[model samples]
Target chain A: MKVAVVKYNAGNVQSVIYALQRLGVNPLHTEDQQEIRTADKVIFPGQGEASSAMDYLRSKGLDQVLTSLTQPFLGICIGLQLMCRHSEEGDTDCLGIFDLEVKRFKVHQHGFKVPHMGWNRLETDNSQLFQAVENPFMYYVHSYYAEVGIETTGITDYILPFSGALQKDNYYAVQAHPEKSSDAGQTILTNFLNI
Target chain B: MLTKRIIPCLDIKNGRTVKGINFVSLVDAGDPVEQAAIYSDAGADELVFLDITATLENRKTLVELVRKVASKINIPFTVGGGISQKEHVSELLNAGADKVSVNSAAVRDPQLIDRLAASFGSQCIVVAIDSRYIEGHDIVHTHGGSRPTELETMAWAQEVERRGAGEILLTSMDHDGTKKGFACDLTRKMSTTLTIPVIASGGGGSAAHFEEVFNGGKADAALAASIFHFHEVDIMDLKKELQAANIPMRI
Candidate 1:
């Protein structure tokens, strides 16, 4: 099975590459439209601002290409947010793969911090990503979260309950970093690769 | 929903992973690449690689190790130690590091902080403050907690933020590895004072420790090394506890 990680100006591609290698899969990392379209599975991964990332995708026409993919595709971190309806970061319109808007964490009156980084537990997953694990913890490092109801497969709280993972049609996106999530993360990737 | 995160900190000396207790055990953990793989598989939310050897001979190798590790993990990783210039920050970011953290370098030459923030943008630059409570003051430490600088932690933090630091990794030299609990008082103050993200490092002994940091300190995130490495606390369990405590976590 072939997996293609969509490449752009975003960082965190290296970690995704390493993650696929460990799973005994040598996936292609590229921004080329044809390669991404032909892969058995595709992963849209990134670590950076939303507006600039969208610009890169739009420049290469990858945004339209990603929105049209028929195969199972996964979005991680910023990738997941980019699949949402819109983002507060850089105030960009996302791919709208999922009817969700990514909003910045509102700082609580008592002074809650943003960029909810670290590992938190996942609960109630029915998707392929949780094939072997039941409500396992995953690694996450993000300040913005998607506000999608029902499509959410996993949820974590910082200031309030936020979407952790979302599923729509053949597209799946997780705000958490599954590649860095250890066994549980690996399990999710393996499941995605297999699907 | 907020997810729980488990992180492993790798102290690098001459491109090798080193671990010390109370910041003094000084044992080789393993090859950084291999250990990083181990931690990532064991379910580390993120990994922190701090270059410990201050010698010039080791700085070059540390950068290469970061490149190697970045090529292997599929997670958000932060690299610290001997990072003082925009060139150093660029090299690491170009090497695939998502974030570059600077400590003593930022304190010594605050301009370097502004330069990096301008070149790479503030989101990619993280300022690590190693603080020690000295006579009711949060004194910034340099050279691996061996020396004290004239900079105050709170004051320097604000300065870095103004200069465009995306986040601050605050480690309490007094509470680190001691596991008594985080410097909740200090973390709470910084989180309240700063608008950027605050990662509370040091003194996490149990799952409750994480809850305490989040509830009492109001920290955005709590980073621990020994507790997770030694199996004293499980990441999922910790998240459950945090969730139970009504702290928003991913579940």
Candidate 2:
């Protein structure tokens, strides 16, 4: 299967590429519009600030290319946040694929970390991305979370319940890093590839 | 709910695992990549590879090792030990390290944290503090905890947080290698005081110790090297025990 991982100013896309490689799929890490559009599956993995990422995407014309893709597209971490309508990080506007707003996690209570790092369980709906994965623990490291909405397919509670996975039509986004989430994560990636 | 993490730290020297790993299943225990995969498969939440190589030439080998580990292992791993510059961090991250940790360099030039956090978001930058309690003071130590600094542990931790560090890897010199237990009081203090997660390192000897660190220490995560490397504690059993103890675990 041809998987094109969207390349931008984001960090950690290499890990996603490695994950795909481990699954026996040689994914193309590219910023070229044609390559991304032509791939069987497009994976948008991110690990950086939203505004700068959006700016890079806009500069490369990938913002438009990404929104127009019809194939099964998956977004991870910052990719998921950027898929939202807006993000409080740098007060940046996103691709508006999910029509949801990403809000920074605000917790004054003890034991509630801002980044929400490490392993957390996912309460998934019947989304194809989480086919075999039921409330399994996945790795999460983010300070902002997309508010749960109608399109929300997975919910995870840290400080409060937020969208862990979102599925709107062909676009699937997860706030956690599936590449780094071990077995359950590999299953999710395999599901995405098979789709 | 986010479960407590169990991290197995691997000491690297010139692209190979330094200490002898007693995993019977590993084809080459010295091979960092092989060791990493075993740990990941055995249910380690994350892995930290500390490169203790001294020469500049050997440091380049660390990046290559990171790339190989990233390609093979499915879990997130952080690379540390002698990472002092933004360029070094960029190389390691580009090679697919999930996070890069700064220790003595961060203590020397605190602005390095700000610069790194500015370039690459705070989520990827970990500030590892090696501290020792002396005369009713938790003093920060540098150069592998052999050298001491005037900076207080709590004050330095708070400063790192304010300067935009994502996580703090606190290794208590007092408790490290003792196998007695983690410095629960100090870890709890750091965990409660800081808004970011605190990874308690140093004195994890048994699964019960892990349970204590998570529940009593209030640590978000706990890291150990010898117990895991020497086959004294199994990650799966540890997680299960932690879960049975009402400490949230992935298993």
Models 1 onward score TM values of 0.81, 0.98
Against the true two-chain complex, what DockQ does each candidate achieve? 0.37, 0.85
- After superposing candidate 1 on the true structure, give the runs of residues whose Cα lies further than 4 Å from its correct spot: A109-111, B1-8, B18-46, B54-57, B67-77, B93-98, B114-124, B133-136, B173-184, B195-251
- Which number leads on TM-score? 2
Error of 2 at B24 (Å): 1.7
Q: Runs in model 2 with CA error above 4 Å?
A: none
TM-score for the first chain of model 2?
0.97
- Output the worst ten-in-a-row residue range by lDDT, candidate 1 chain A: A109-118
Error in Å for residue A70 of model 2:
1.0
Model 1 Cα lDDT, one tens digit per residue, A1-195: 878999898764777877788889899988889999999999998788899999999999998999999999999999999999899998999898888889998877455545566667666466677789754777777789898587888787668888888888889888878876766788898898878
